[model samples]
Target: MDEDYDYFQELRDFLGGTFHQDISSPEQALDEYINEANKECLLFTIRYCDEFLTSNRTKQEKENYIQTNAEIYFPAIGLTPLIWLNNVVEQIKEAVKLK
Candidate 1:
């Protein structure tokens, strides 16, 4: 949680400096700060999940856990954030391609 908070703070400072004087509203500010964080988190989560899937030991157990968690809990808690984070990821990817 502390690491997450620090990443967001650093993002806010970086983007705020870049978009200085144009960013408006708390929601906009948060969106700016969290967009990069969301991208990193999405990449990290997918990579970690893939690593867990590939691990020789307990691969089946990890698969069962992810399957059950997705079926039972992720629907209720995951869709919105996943969608929003995905959108942020696309934006970041596009930005990278342009540069």
Candidate 2:
């Protein structure tokens, strides 16, 4: 990756800059469900995941990073830590593929 290639920014751009919105929900009007706290929490998680991916570290190292921050980052989201981690990883992978 180039020095200017930011995974967090890339992910945000791929998401049309609403990286905090509920893209997973199938609701017709998302604004009805937009919770400020939830959005802030998602932003942190996404930024951490971006750090995970862009670090280019080994699997063990990445998992360690997540585990270390698990308590801080995984509480606000409704899903379990493992599920949220997997979903974010998959989403970022798909985003990378698009580029």
Candidate 3:
């Protein structure tokens, strides 16, 4: 976890520059899906989740919100969701395999 490694940018560069010819479309699709997910989150989902922290809302209100809209707060609905989630798991597996 070198702070300067710029993992996301380097990964994007490697995908866009090194393997551009082979995986450009798939990468773009994935990138677009990520962007759409970001939009979905910031506009609707985050505010909904943030309401849980509201001092104005009672505990019952928080419970109602969670009961009604928990799924939207789960994030990363498709494509790379699991891949994004288990990044540590994937890295650990790779490290073990390389050992």
Best by TM-score: 2
Regions of candidate 2 where Cα sits further than 4 Å from its true position: 1-34, 37-48, 72-84, 88-99
lDDT of 3 by residue, 51-89 (tens): 324337666654443334222222434433223323322
With a 3 Å backbone cut-off (N, CA, C), the pairs that clash in candidate 3 are none
lDDT score for residue 11 of model 1: 34
Over 1-99, each residue of candidate 1 has an lDDT whose tens digit, in order, gives: 233443323333443453344555423643564455555554443344334435564645543443333222334434443343344445555544443
* Window of ten residues with lowest summed lDDT in model 3: 40-49
Instruction: Score every model by TM-score.
Output: 0.30, 0.32, 0.25
lDDT of 2 by residue, 10-98 (tens): 54343333333445441222222233225444444456556756676776665554444433234455655345556655654444444
User: Candidate 1: which stretches are off by over 4 Å?
Assistant: 1-37, 72-99
Where does candidate 2 clash, by residue pair?
none
What alpha-carbon RMSD in Å does predicted model 3 have with respect to the real structure? 14.5
- Estimate the TM-score for candidate 3: 0.25
lDDT of 3: 0.36
For every model shown, the clashing-pair count is: 0, 0, 0
